[model samples]
Target chain A: MGLNLDYKAELDNIIRDHIDMEGPLLPVLHAVMARFSHIPKDAIPIIARKLNLSSAEVSGVVSFYHDFKKEKVGRHKVQICRSEACQAMGSRELEVHAKKSLKVDFGESTNDDLIFLEPVYCLGNCACSPSVRIDDEIHARVTPSGFDKLISDLRSVNHHKARNS
Target chain B: MRKLFIPNDTSAVAMGSNLVANRFEELIKNKSLDIQIIRNGSRGMFWLEPLVEFESDFKRFGFQSVDLSEVESILEFICDDSFDAALNKHPKFLGETESIEYFKKQQRLSFFRSGLGDPLCIDHYSSLEGFTGLKKALEMQPQQIVDEVKNSGLRGRGGAAFPTGIKWQTVLDTAHSKKYIVCNADEGDSGTFADRLLMESDPYQLIEGMIIAGLAVNANQGYIYLRSEYPFAHATLNTAISRCYAEGILGQNVLGKKICFELEVRLGAGAYICGEETSLLESLEGKRGLVRSKPPLPAIEGLFGCPTVVNNVLTLGAISTILCKGSDYYKNYGTGRSRGTLPVQLSGNIKRGGLIEIPFGISLREIVEDFGGGTFSGNPVKAIQVGGPLGAFVDRDKWDTPMDYEAFSAINSMIGHGGIVVFDDQINMFDQARFAMEFCAIESCGKCTPCRIGSTRGLEVLDKISSKKDVEDNLILLEELCDTMEHSSLCAMGGMTPFPVKSAVELYKEDFT
Candidate 1:
């Protein structure tokens, strides 16, 4: 009950802050996604109500964009660039290596819910191809070995925190 | 005391600039060094980053690809009595930043101040002639400003080569209580980072350009619709914008004048269609980024149904130079109607790849071989995709074609957003052609049937051709599909999706068979 109330309070603050801005929907949705990692299903109606929009309109926006997540994602979200520039520099091979190592295809989370893999069109790092973004940090010139190191680093850091707690 | 410049640009940071900077700080402190480390923007030299530039006797020289291992030795070189000579003997030394042959052979007007000083420093910006354009624009009338832009021959750098002066003139002529200057910073091209570079490096230049645009169009408000993929640019622009506001460059009083111009940066959801003007406006209005039809062009009715002048980031960036140095100065560069330098992005399977800003008439071969230094894999170059995904793939035969807007259009290709993605001979053109169709299908806004359904169908037909079961029939069907999408689609998303596919089939038919 306490967690639910806290979540609701947070959602209300996000809607209230962005409601007065010009075209407040994307901003409100972006804020919600940033805070929650994914737009909570219940937050949609609340956002629509504050912005004088329909739930359907709000939901349509969430579905239309690839950034707005429908459900909870893993702790570490990995996006591999699948665009032509990255492909030209062996992104296809990188993508294959990533999926195999993660033991999951694009848009799937591992059974441990630690790593989620998705294919992003472009991250604007084309100058250094075969780019990968783990959460917010972008890694460039990423080979199979480089990817393995990145994943291991993430796991080790998280494991260290978990053990400390 | 000498200053050490390290790039905080996204590409530089991604290549571990932060790690090098941290190590350098530790090394400098331990050695009790008098050098200052400034986190500047990238010089568009990706291969040589994290490039560390040291100031010695009023000249800036760089050391390429500096990592943690070289941090201590670099500090020693910085502390050396004969700094320039010691740095020259250092294995990773790159002479002077501007005198490098790759950077020396080009024209850099819009990107004049990039990688020079701290991007966020207002004092540094002013010293480099940052707001001179705005000062000139303030002295001129609205019509005069528009006329100057028109005379400069500046076109929309986003994709369409539409004259910018005419668009501003339309907005200025149209009387409305509310007007807008929308800077299309939604740079979604796969092999392009010019917009990101400008925003991240010389951010105040973009802000100054937007201010000039707002003043010219009599629009008191401006919005930069930036893509979410560019988190670095978003943060840089926001910080630069806040700095502008604090310094009285933005908000109610424009540089203490009675005029008022406000600016804000709006983020785009992960939709490539939002790069389109109308779609960008729709997305800005907090709705699905569906493409709006023409007849009421964006110049007449744009964001929130008001008269708006939507210009690409580079086009707006050029406005400052044109206003400060005069239209004739800008018009002196480039050949034919495309008068000005274009910042061409060299990326994807290329050696020495980075940003190349040059006049329009430079050939593709000059760009790929001379500047880019050929493929990274050392393989024979198979094909090159000029522009973005919607751009055509040019074969070896077309390498000599001059890279102006007119020359490219004559060959069913375009220098769209000035992005050049190279592919080695190892790449399968059949797969590339299929990927273009698939990309369209994935990104189409579903507003038009031709782009939405046609893309999926086109992908399926390509897959069928790949299977070799009904190859001849599928090839004919693909051509028809390409024709339909080219003519019937609402916007470039649908209309130009066939460019890569058609060009691939024409140039590399062996891959298809």
Candidate 2:
């Protein structure tokens, strides 16, 4: 499939603005991934050529870090804290609940392209326990029922925004 | 007019301050009481958050976890001083936070204004001795500023106990016109929350410290590379920066001086390795949070090819205090070479899981038994991890070791981020050791070979040892791999992963063999 023009422009700008012009190809690739929702597979060669790095080197860097993604993500990304602090606060159960509710495993996007689920380390809100972030908004002390409500609410909001647009 | 400061921190809100705040506002409107309520950050008495402080005759009276339903009663008591025992809405623990032993024992240099002043307001910070350091720093040469910090003996609280003054001096000496100050706020250590508390409670202190660093180092721009996990902190810090800019605490010619200092918060996507300085820089530059090879240390060439002084949040937070209170005053608290108070975060299977700032040289025994009040499991304490997941697991036999950097290092352990996690007899040392390697394997940035593959191999060897498959052979192999990783890895994630694994194996040989 052809790349989205706006998305490509935005990604290029992010790469140019954030990543270094030379040396250490991994960080640049990582930066690209961080800016764009995902690292477009086609951009790998472009990034490699800019950094004077091998395509294998770029791919190696991209695949090494778990946070890097190769494909586009959903509109809303839900990251659940699976670190020890959250684990102590029953995140294991919450993780299971999230998987069942979302009908996808960690690092997987929903079929509807609404929400993508991922595992995060400590959110620094350990005192509250079981913290989850939906894009920029962090929710704490999330129960299974609360998780369901949160996902549904987010989905509905996404739908509303979609319709509005 | 009575001035009241109600903490708006999440910890405070979790303890039900939002409802209380609304009620206080309602009562003021209803009674037409001459009162102004300012929502500030908490004062570290986490158990007593939703802490309401009422200023009377320049003295602040505190009420913890004040319920909204009790607001009217509290107002009546405050207004009348009537002997309505039932109506007196005092917290479970009454009196000023300073009087509490948990707080009183702490010297609180770094966290001096935290939980006491409005984090987002520069006025509150200035009123509480914030910019005094920046003013002092600007008056002197960069070398003088560096000398003062060196005299204070303040070490990097970001795991490595390298002297802060030396680092600053090195960065100063390094020739680069476009120098940068990067504050490592990606505090992902499981047992640590000092950075988070500082960010949420007293963000201005961090800003002031950064401004001072910028002025001293002749840097124009800075970035606080905070973890994406801390959404609240991100918002709080952003608010603080805007306020600082408006108040001339940040931006060009800060405090009407020729010095120019600007700060921005860069959020790192979920990556534990970013806690490492090089990895943090990489992440800040919008790359994967991967470790970078040293020799061109961040001080010489860092953050988009500039001389950047990358410091831990606490290390920078402590700088303002050192400058404000004088190096001698700051250094007088701790023993040995480890000067000044350290904000030790007590967490994980401990009764009192919170932040406590105590003088260096305080024994781990005091922290575990006295401050922590022992393990939360109520079982006898067996082993405790002094640092984060990467730190060593010290058996109770070594509990008397002083919390100073020298002492911890002497005991084959480094106080990485001052995170102490207690574990009872129920904890299996073998399993804990395995978990450490597993954690490293999972979080390694894969920049270096030893860290990337060695961690996974270490885990496999640990599995062999744990399963008792030629346990002796596996144990030797584990040690060999740990040594290789320790000597070869680019960053501490690989260097220190061996600490817990090796320490666990050494301390509790019976568990593995």
Candidate 3:
């Protein structure tokens, strides 16, 4: 988040570390995303040149994968399992509830850019069903109300942080 | 002072294990009770999650699904100490862990350590005969180790049911100076969580298995190609690996032996097709997760063109057990070709949904009704998908069929990754069939036209049929398209997509037309 628009040096360092790898494009792109939550638009050409690939090739690789984001997203990323396993357990209702609670659809962030909702296939917790991933932690068997509580907890954590700061 | 064992497994956590853990900790501290709480892996009885077990008469006594609200009352009886009979009187108490009927029926050879102890702690793992496999492996010749696995009949648990030892043998005999062992942890299966459970709950077993695999194939380096979705598994595995390295079970010289084995976890960027070995190899190489045509097979040319041995987490996870427990012990359980225990995951609308490690030859009826306790909603069961997304759908008549690779294959289906997803009578088989095609279209690597074009076309046909636009003709065309995809696709992603679609149509044609 601290990095600016000119992240060429940071980008090069990531590319350099993985360029010697057999197929370096994916790893390098992964590294960039790991460092900065989303890969910046400008980093594509830089990655392409280092990997000796065209900008289109680099962009295609990034866009093909669902994990990669083309642009910035909200601070607190919320993902609901959209796979059949969760769907069988009424995740369709959970998804609708999450969207309404966040006041944002699947790809949209909140007005204050606090929470972003996305659909993930399976969180590998099929038994619990209706799983939700808030940032890096996955919560299982989530209901619409349960999802609301988690969001409220996140908002309150931020509220407390702001007041203290 | 008493000890309590509560699961910190992913599914357990999802079912309010954390809240219960926190509450238990706070209550014990407030009461100044000297009770120790251990966050063990799930017992695989998900319906009884947040399940708490305490030491009583030198055995672990149980409390099934202890909610956070009941943490105080449960602690109240426990804080009095002396293994109180009053605490045992709690309604949730299931007497002892060993007495539970669901766990009693399981043939827990490979999963012996899972859901029983702390995964991250070396002591927790070692306390339960952990490094004995690796320790035994270090003394035996590489061929001996391979023979042990071969004798045990451990097939790849990553859905293919390929002989894991044979895959190891090919790499062992390849005569390459540099070889690699890769654990395909991509687990994209909709209903499967056994791999995730093993990796997260008892990661050391997988690490131990990989180290043994490295030793068997004469390979020094290993990689676990994990999917990005399982952040918890990734974190647990990484931590466990670091712990293993510190414990001297891994790194430059395993257990102070001259042989060296190192392991790393590589994250796969959201691609379901990457579960295929070559695609996983491609993804690991930092390329697009595209399926590669097999000629040289991955055991010959894999992972930067090295002679690589790729096995699923379950396959590798079984290695340590086979070596430690002896091959015959492992072989004694399973029936026919599907030897050794299968950690079958019961999920999706199941009542007592969890992991059940039964030997081969168990009937679907036994698994679904007996172990799983039937549908969660108490609704009548309709169809059950025996594998992942690409696996076939079985109608009600087939519930009596045994679960094994050979048996499933006999019915034009396979127990892919050993995940059985239950669907209630409320399900629309037509939509499920359409979903199979849609899933394939979304995940097709575009390297082959049969999978890529056929999938999209299949979806179109299904849409037309669902809309009642010449339904009879559309079904015939869909059947033809499915045949084309099954015969012509480069990999299982395309080839096997027809299994679910065709099975759905055959079983529930009335629902469609």
Candidate 4:
């Protein structure tokens, strides 16, 4: 069941911590994603073996959920809420501007890997429609220009970090 | 020495409270002022957020949108001798926290302690009548507890409007040694913030209510399936749950009584369907959030194929008040079967968008006009969606309709989660209807054909209609698709996606043309 040597210890501990619980697949999967930022395909066989579920069963749960990404996301995940509330506030226009500025679609990341654009159903800030969540922080009342400026800020930060490195 | 408060509620954070809180703390230290800043949950008044409130002689007064540069000035003003006069003159100052007309008008039964105190502090919570409901429940028998709820006429605020007592009674009557109480906190509804507010502002209230529910249903284990989008609520709830355990309110022999209840929180993975109780249970079990077929309702066979009482956040949050105030007191508020206060969330293109907890019989016009202050765009509100994404697109003519389950149901609409999303005249109903289909297509679990396929087809038809490609024929086809999806779907996810589409076409007939 060995796939790769990377994160083997973290994967084993995650499996050990949750393997005893009923319906342990999702918890173990969340833990793996938390550590790796995205669920590694190699870890699936190890989880499947430990949980005694088939590899397909484990991967099925992972792929079914939007939160579980197969690859690493950008440094900052920018999620624009696309629900009806936001749509009423011109979120469709915001989305177009966001994608064009970021040079990425809803689930894609930038070439520089500075920003990842994602679509969220609702952040429960419908009062401030056209809301955007950068990492865990929410930015409200965002127009197309506001979104572009936000992207510029994120890119500048990434540029500074890259320069330092 | 004085105390100040800043909201850590997600909405407030969105409006720059995090920076405000940081800057205020730094300025207080730099100026050597004897002031403490507490990051509290939002007061549900969003328009004037990053609202900084300070305690002066036991009466709290506040300033709205406290900026980084203004922190020092506000600190000096608060530390001044004529604080009251200064507050009166300050344009941003909202005289008294409790006396604001917006906060004063509404009856805040479920949200009694929200945005008023440190959510994690047990002392502050208890002082605000937090555990009064649980204390009463601790003394009563299980059936008596259920009976009290039954008499209160509290229905599920999660949009189903099912009687809360009957759902509890089913789990109570069911013979199972290991039953569970699961709270559905996965509030994905576009206009809903009531659940998020309660969870973040007063986490212990939900904990107390869940503990009371556990006592009522004879269940010792409880799980709250919270949405992943609400990271603030997640952290707050976890801390509050730990506090409950440490305070002897949640472990074996709760408060030295024979009751033992252990609480846990599971996160939903960004799926709208998980808001459905059956799908919530599925997600709680660490699986795909696919809606389970009913008849074996979540009450009969829920989480892990055992008897489980699944209640929404507001439903459980209301338990404490119901227990403390008696069922009759709660039943006295609203009209007919829809008893008690409904936390109606007014949002989306709204001037005064926030959580309004009122009696169920309040008219849509009053909520949208009087309380909401009309559209933010200054245009006439063309349509108001009373429920969530799946709710009907109600026209302006229906403004005077009483927002009750029955009244709304009669008009092909629902008070689903009591969230009203206002759309101004600039909105195109046809486009909105198309979005309803597209959203369903994107979020549907792909378990059923009606929701999975029908939603996509619905979008295509809407596109055809919008482009004027055989408009008459496309309209007929779209209507037929809506009917098929409504009738043939496996769950409400499939069944209700057609609601917005059909209602739009019906009410704004000109939009389609």
Best-performing candidate as measured by lDDT: 1
- Among residues 3 or more apart in sequence or in different chains, the pairs in candidate 2 whose N, CA or C atoms overlap within 3 Å are A30-B287, A30-B288, A31-B286, A31-B287, B42-B115, B43-B115
Ranking by DockQ: 1, 4, 3, 2
All candidates in order of lDDT, best leading: 1, 4, 3, 2
What is the CA-based DockQ of model 3? 0.66
Q: Encode model 3's per-residue lDDT on A60-153: one tens digit a residue.
A: 7788788888878888888898777787788878988888777788988899888878888788989889799888788878888888899999
**Candidate 1 colliding pairs:** none
Question: How many angstroms is residue B328 displaced in model 4 relative to the true structure, after the best TM-score fit?
Answer: 1.9
Candidate 2 or 1, higher lDDT: 1
Compute the TM-score of each model's chain A versus the native chain A and list the values. Answer: 0.94, 0.84, 0.91, 0.89
Candidate 2 error regions (>4 Å): A5-68, A72-77, A85-103, A109-115, A127-131, A134-165, B13-35, B63-80, B83-93, B286-289, B377-382, B424-430, B465-468, B507-513
What's the TM for model 3? Answer: 0.96
Order by TM-score, highest first:
1, 4, 3, 2
Candidate 3 lDDT over B1-513, as tens digits, reads 688888987788888898899998888888788899988887778888888988867887788888877888787766664546676677786887877999999988777777777888887788888888988988888899999988888888999888888988899999888899999999998999999988888898899899998888899999999999998898999898887789778889888889889888888888898899998998787667788999889999998899999999999888888888899998998889989888899888889888999999999999999988888889988888989898898867778889888988888888999988898888888988988898888889999999999999999999999899999899999999999999999999999999999999999888898
> What is the total number of backbone clashes in candidate 1?
0
Please give, for residues B1-513, the per-residue lDDT of candidate 2 as tens digits. 878888876556655677788989988999899889988877766645667878766767777667777687678767764523532345443655577677777777777777776778776788988788888988899888889999999989888888999889988998777999999998988767889889998998888889888877878899998876777798999998998888787888788988888788876656789888988887666566777878788998899979999999999998899899899998898889888888888765566556788898889999878887876658887787878888888766778998988898888887889887677676677877887788888888877999999999998998877777998888888889999999999888898899888988888888887
Best by DockQ: 1
Clashing pairs in 4: none
Those runs of model 1 whose alpha carbons end farther than 4 Å from true positions after fitting are: A1-3
